[model samples]
Target: MDVRLFKQVRAACNASTEKVADGLVGTIVEIGGDPLTVRKAKDRLSAVLQKARNGVPQLVGGPKKGEEMAVVISVRDLAELVVAARQQETLGEALDAIGFKPYRGAHILVGQSRKRERLKRSGDAPSAATAN
Candidate 1:
C-alpha cells in the first residue's frame, strides 16, 4: 500500500482498538472479580466461541473497574489482524529505506518534502507529475 493509505489504515486500527477497549465495539462480558460470573462464563465458553465465529467479538473484562480486558475473536479475525500487522511492518521498512520518518501525528511523515527535494536535485527520483 502507498504511504497515505497505510497511514489511514493505521489510524483507523488505533481508533478501533480504543473503541473496543471502551466496550463500544461488541458484547462485553464482565468476569474476573465475581467467582460465580466467571464460572458461568467458563460454562458457556462454547456459546461465546460461537458468537465470536459469527463476527461478534466477546470483550472479556475484569471484575474491577478500569481494569484491562481481553477479547475473544474468531480465528478468521485474528488472521486478518496478523496479515495487516505484517503488511504494516513491511511498509514501514520500505518507508524507512526511502527516508520517510514517522512523525508526531498518524498522517505526518517527517522530512518527506525535504527528501523529495533532495532526490529531485540529485536526479535520483522521478517526478510523478511529469511522468505521465
Candidate 2:
C-alpha cells in the first residue's frame, strides 16, 4: 500500500536485530513455536511490518509485546534469509518468479547475495596450538 512506509518497515526490521543483540531491545516472550531462532527473528520483523500495514506506529511494540513488541533480529539472520529467498537474484526477479505482482511503481529492496563470510572449519585452518 504505502511504498515509502514499506521501505521504512524493512529498514526498521533490519535495525531491530542490532538493538536486540546489543541488549538495547527485547522481544516478545510468547514464542510462536518456531524453534529456529532465525525464524523467530524474521517473525518479529514480519510482525513489525504487519503493524505498520495496520497503521500502527512502526517500532511501537516492545520486546515482549508490551502494547507493541517489535521483533529482534541480527544482521546475520536477515542477510541469510534474504540470500535464501533471492539466491543470487534481485527482488524483482524473485517476485516475478514467484508470481507476486507488486503494486505498480512499488519499489522492493533488491536482495543480492554477492558476498559471504565463510566459516573456517577446525581442520581447514591450523591454530597456534596445532602449528609447531
Candidate 3:
C-alpha cells in the first residue's frame, strides 16, 4: 500500500474498538445477500477489487444471519494487518516479560515470581508461614 493508505489502516487497527475503526478505514460496501445479489457480486468482482485497492473495503456477510462476515481488502492492506497483528503480539510478550499478566482481557502488573521472591526475602511482603 502507499504511505497514506498504510497510515490510515494502521490508525484503524490501533483504534480502541472495532466500531470506531470501521469509520477510520473508509468506505465499506456491505453485501448482505440473496442468490441474485451473490451472482451480481461475482460478476462485479473485478470492480469491487479495484475499489478495495483504492481503500474501500467490502464486507460480505454470510449466507445465514448471525454467521461470520468476511472482508475484502487489497493484498497490501492484508500485509499491513498481518504486521500490525504481529506488533500486538510482540507488545503482549514484552508486557509479560515486565511482570504484566493478562487479566479479564487487559494487562495487570502482577509482579513476576522472581520479584515476589525477592520482596519476600527483604521483608517487604508477608511470608507464607506468617500468612497462616
Candidate 4:
C-alpha cells in the first residue's frame, strides 16, 4: 500500500473535517460508519489510553493491568463514505463536493480506483465493483 498516498488522503480529510473542542484537539472520529458516524469508538479508545496513562480504570477480578477496549471499524463505514461521495453525478463533482480538487479525469479515475482497491482489500465487494 502507498503509505504516502494514504497519509495524503487522511491529512486532506482531517484538515477538512476535524475541529477543536473543549480546549482540546478533536477530529471527527468516525466509527464503524461513514464520516457521520458517532465518535464513540475514537472517544472510547482515547478514554482508555488516557486512563491507562493516569493509572485509572483499574481492572477488577483480574490482573492489575488495564481493561482491554475493542473498537473495530466495519467495512460498511468505508463503503458509506465511498457511496456518499460517488452519489454525485460525476466523479469530478463528487471529489469537489468532498473538498478534494480534481483537475483531470485521470485524478478522479485514480481516486475511484483507490477506493475500489480499498473495498477489495476490505473483502466487502461493493456492487459498483461488479458493474464494471
Model number with the top lDDT:
3
RMSD in Å for candidate 4, one decimal? 21.0
TM-score of every candidate relative to the true structure? 0.41, 0.21, 0.40, 0.20
lDDT of 2 by residue, 1-132 (tens): 223323333334335665533332222222222222444546676775554344333332333433434443444444544545344246765575668965798587988877878889978998898788
- How do the residues 1-132 of candidate 3 rate in per-residue lDDT, one tens digit apiece? 445444454445445676544543333322222222445558888976786787666665545765545666788777876675445336765585467965677676796565443325465777799899
Error of 3 at 62 (Å): 5.5
Off by over 4 Å in 2: 1-66, 88-95, 98-132
Ranking by lDDT: 3, 1, 2, 4
Candidate 3 lDDT score relative to the true structure: 0.56
What total of clashing residue pairs does each candidate reach? 0, 9, 0, 0
What TM-score should be assigned to candidate 3?
0.40
Candidate 1 residues lying further than 4 Å off, grouped into runs, are 1-9, 12-37, 86-99, 102-132
- In model 4, which runs have C-alpha deviations exceeding 4 angstroms? 1-25, 30-72, 89-132
Where is the poorest 10-residue window by lDDT in model 1? 26-35
Instruction: Encode model 1's per-residue lDDT on 29-98: one tens digit a residue.
Output: 2321222234565888997778778755566544677665566767886666556544544676657546
Top-scoring candidate (TM-score): 1
